[model samples]
Target chain A: MKLRKSEDSENEVELNMTPMIDVVFLLIIFFMVVSELSTLNLEEIELPLADESEVLKSEKLDARHIICNVREDGTIRIQGNSYKKEQLADYLKVEADAEEREPANPSNPAVPPSKLYLTIRAHKDTKFENVQNVFDACSQNGIYKTRVMATKDE
Target chain B: MIARLLRRRPRSRSSRPKAVEEAKLELTPMIDCVFLLLIFFMCNLEFVKQDGLIKAFLPKDRGQSTGPSVTDLGEVRVKLLWCAPGTTIETEDRDVGEVVLKIEKNVYPRSGATPDWEMLYLDLVKMRDIRDRSGNPDALPVIIDARPLVPHAAVVGALNACVKARIKDVTFAAPERPF
Candidate 1:
């Protein structure tokens, strides 16, 4: 009986989680690092606001006009003219160049002409894809400054 | 030594048998893997939650545009009106007009006389010029009014034009749709 009891005690099973925990922690760290890296290359998207404050009196907003109009027939116009959907990149490049040339003021002396402001006017029925396209164009052309125009209800 | 000597009574010809048991999986390792996977997915997931994609008009300090004097300060109010296939655009202020371009029935051809593309590009360039001349390019706010039937592609084209023209501020005017 004593020998049998000793044998039974030797056969008892138990699990060790130390190595498993170590592997899990390592994996967690790996994922954390990867997620951080992935976000670095992600695009910065500005969500459209409903209750945005009015244009400030600061002098930074003193140059360049960007008017976007979305029509019912699926026609898009900047100012009065419509642009081909594909030529957005080229157009932005040209606009950015023009903005760089026109100095905001010759008398200010402190403000460089390189600053250009952008105004995006999207219609109520406009698709999100259209807005994204505009953003993409601006990013490609190095025009980071932007604003949204809204109308007040009576 | 005395115990061994006492136990050594009979010498039988028999070899010691080998002990064997079935292999078993470690539940702890699998549980740990499940937890790790859960954490990975939770961290990597990007949830995109946005209120409706309508343009919001920010408050202008000057209040609302009421009369001619307000309009003369080089405040260019560019209005976009949305319409159906054959509907004409109407505006609250008659002076603020709508530019209509018909959508061609044929597929937008890649080559032969891309009139639509040319028109859109020209309009954007012209607006840019006006905004630059206004001296306050950043404040040149453009408002867009669109109907329900308008295709989303058209709106995108408009946005692209604004970006191309270096116009940063844009707002959409939406009135509650009556059911």
Candidate 2:
């Protein structure tokens, strides 16, 4: 009689943990995948500072625009090479053509538009003529959206 | 009659109650989850934020001419005028100690004709050096009066030199020309 009672008590103490552990492991995998897709390029470039002014909101991605760095000593660097104001229009025209052919999605037959957005970084002491040349090139190339890079005032 | 003989008799004492199982917390898995979230936020934060260091002084409205006098008493004004190959810089309205011309040079040995950027840089440096030694560094604001025909790249070059010299205040005075 005593042996039969002990066996019945042991059978009633069973616990189920499969469902709880399944939820925890699912959350871990989700976060791991999201972290991988949010990486961005963090390069060091000097941006001109502006006075107290309202911020201009823009949605253009960095890859879609041409970045030009104008040094204080009248040196125009486009993608790391020195260029004169007169040479900018021709160079940009070639770049715009190349961008049109290299579609972001190769599977799609439709090509992306070759609209160029220019981001200019000028130093405080730079001559007005040097900065003006860049603006002229953009207009000549049919690129209307020109943004001057400025640091936020704190 | 045989089954009854094999069965045991019940005890006269009362039976004891069954006890419940104790619940305990597991912290190892929870700790791992917390660490993963911490790493995610750290990587996404932008550390080196760029902000504007220079302040621009806009020209006062012509209607409000009584606001303040526009003078070079405590500021350094650089007026840039465009000239043709043989045209003199003094023909413009502004006065300066000297005027430098930026002409294209041939730098490519193979092509025999390439634009040289070194001369432009040298001229800018000399201009900045002259401005720095002129007066009190903190009191003087650098004013750039650009000609309409000047190239945009030249203006950027001049601005870059001011930044290199750590001049925080700059302004643009546009010429009276129909755009």
Candidate 3:
């Protein structure tokens, strides 16, 4: 009797999953880093639409921009913490001082104190006085770069 | 003689059985976790960052009066009047009833009657364009006087109209009178 060849009897194709898994893992890491960096702590609210509103392209360059939110009920929140107008002013003063003392760059230590930008995100129905109060706080602390957040009109 | 020589060759002392084949990596669980993370991030990603910004200059003096009788100032004034719904009871979260936009002698929607923001926008664009053609500075200041009872949305709508006309210098009048 003739001996049957074992290798010829079991000629099956197999897929190599190593490269696919490596690509999937790379994509996962990329998304994780982007989501963490872009997350905003403020609550989402209905912002007013503006025809002439300009896009903020320099947000990534500046790390000292202050973000404040005003709810529909006229309450102000900063970094997820509620604050009365008086307390908010005090808080802004401390932030302004801290920003003034921080160096623009570690390598270039001779730069002047960079101006702090205050970004106010208020609901469409939020009282104007609520925004004005935050404005008052910024002026009192000598922080003049103020921006009101609005939706771009399509 | 050759067959006898091959059979007589002794096995070397260092010769040993080869090690078993390396274990295969489990990819099923790892691929599942990766797909889950990919979905989570895709849902949360905000591509356009739809929020825009309007730069504002707050009064440094806390809106204190400087003086009176500056009538020579040729700034255009736009007034926004808020009207409550014709109901006996008013709730804390009552919807903003109606808004009337007024510019000089002409009243929008109707003369002290109805609220129509579309008409107000058209009129504002017309006035702004006429001034621009008359060699006036493009950045003419507009004063938006809103009532104390006016909802902020109403004021923003008026502001949107002014901005649509390419008029950037906007200042809000102090809401002094009690509603």
Candidate 4:
């Protein structure tokens, strides 16, 4: 049998692109806005107010600094990523290793604990044992410079 | 002459089609990819952490006792006590069943037997002033002795009270009884 000529070949199809470009621009804007909203890598928890809490400034918002979050349900999250409680120390170790290297001072050599800073963001309602476990993990992994985050009381 | 113009019209339409096609950037595929990316981001977005950092020392490792002497109560020893769920009486000031804070044997809200952070802050301020009046150049360290079962909020509440009083030297004491 002879092949039949295509029926739609007589008409030239032109695809409209304005809507596509408009949608793409919108998507790019949406992603950019949401990404900026997530600068801190943790979940929002009701923090206990300390009338005397000091406002601390993080050195760099990058990987050199790490955040460990303990939710009210005792779930542990590291840098917005979930981790089993048993694996907390290993995660901190990996993050510490990934930290940027610093030049060792000749007079006062920096120790492993001094290299990276660890921050614990525990929920106000979370059990003290949960926070202590994470703190123990920090101690075990040689993470000495640790900060417990809280909100200033009104 | 008429035949020549007609021939040029067909040629122009065919040849100029390439320019028209090039002007239309075929952004549908790119838009599709962006939509996929947007969906990925939306599905993965988690809650943002809004709490601020309060510089606190980690607990002393097990069996390592480098803490100050027990006689240094004047140095601001804020003890946090956790009550059983049913034993805690509901107070107008604090939520029911919250941990209590004690400074120098004086419990917050001496009358209600509930957590009163404001009163705790005043005491810490006095302790800080006493330390400063003693002519100590170094910042005075405040010991936070919290029970293992106490909620972190109570510990943080005590710490915040100290920090709000400008007592920055904060340290956590090992739980008297391990969990």
Most TM-score-accurate candidate: 3
- Between the candidate structures 3 and 4, which one is better when assessed by TM-score? 3
lDDT tens digits by residue: candidate 2, B1-179: 22223222333212533463333455456547655665554554533354332223232222112334454455555444454333433334222212333322322122101112344335445655676788556533566655644444334445545555555555554334343
**Candidate 1 lDDT, B1-179, residue by residue in tens:** 32233234233323333453433444555565669685765656554222222222232222122333323343433333332223344334323333333322222222211124345445556766877786764655544443333334344445444545545555443332335
Clashing pairs in model 3?
none
Predicted structure 4, TM vs. truth:
0.64
Candidate 3 off by > 4 Å? A1-37, A58-63, A97-114, A142-144, B1-27, B59-72, B86-97, B104-106, B110-115, B129-138, B175-179
Better of 1 and 3 by TM-score: 3
Please, what is the whole-model Cα lDDT of each candidate in the order they appear? 0.45, 0.49, 0.65, 0.65
- For the candidates in turn, chain A alone yields TM-scores of 0.51, 0.54, 0.67, 0.65
Error of 2 at A3 (Å): 31
Off by over 4 Å in 2: A1-48, A52-63, A99-114, B1-45, B50-145, B148-179
lDDT of 2: 0.49
Among all windows of 10 consecutive residues in model 4 chain A, the one with the lowest summed lDDT is A105-114
- Weakest lDDT window of 10 consecutive positions for candidate 4 chain B: B2-11
Tell me the lDDT of model 4 at B62. 22
lDDT of 3 by residue, A51-90 (tens): 6677867676756887898888988987778899999989
| Model 1 Cα lDDT, one tens digit per residue, A22-95 | 66667777776666654432222222233322444543555765655544333555645676556766776677
How many steric overlaps are in each model, in order? 30, 41, 0, 7
Best by DockQ: 4
Show model 4 residue runs off by greater than 4 Å: A1-40, A50-58, A61-63, A97-112, A151-154, B1-50, B59-74, B84-97, B107-114, B176-179
Tens-digit lDDT track of model 2 for A22-104: 55455556655544432222123455443332244454565476667777666777765778878887897677666543333
DockQ of each: 0.06, 0.06, 0.30, 0.32
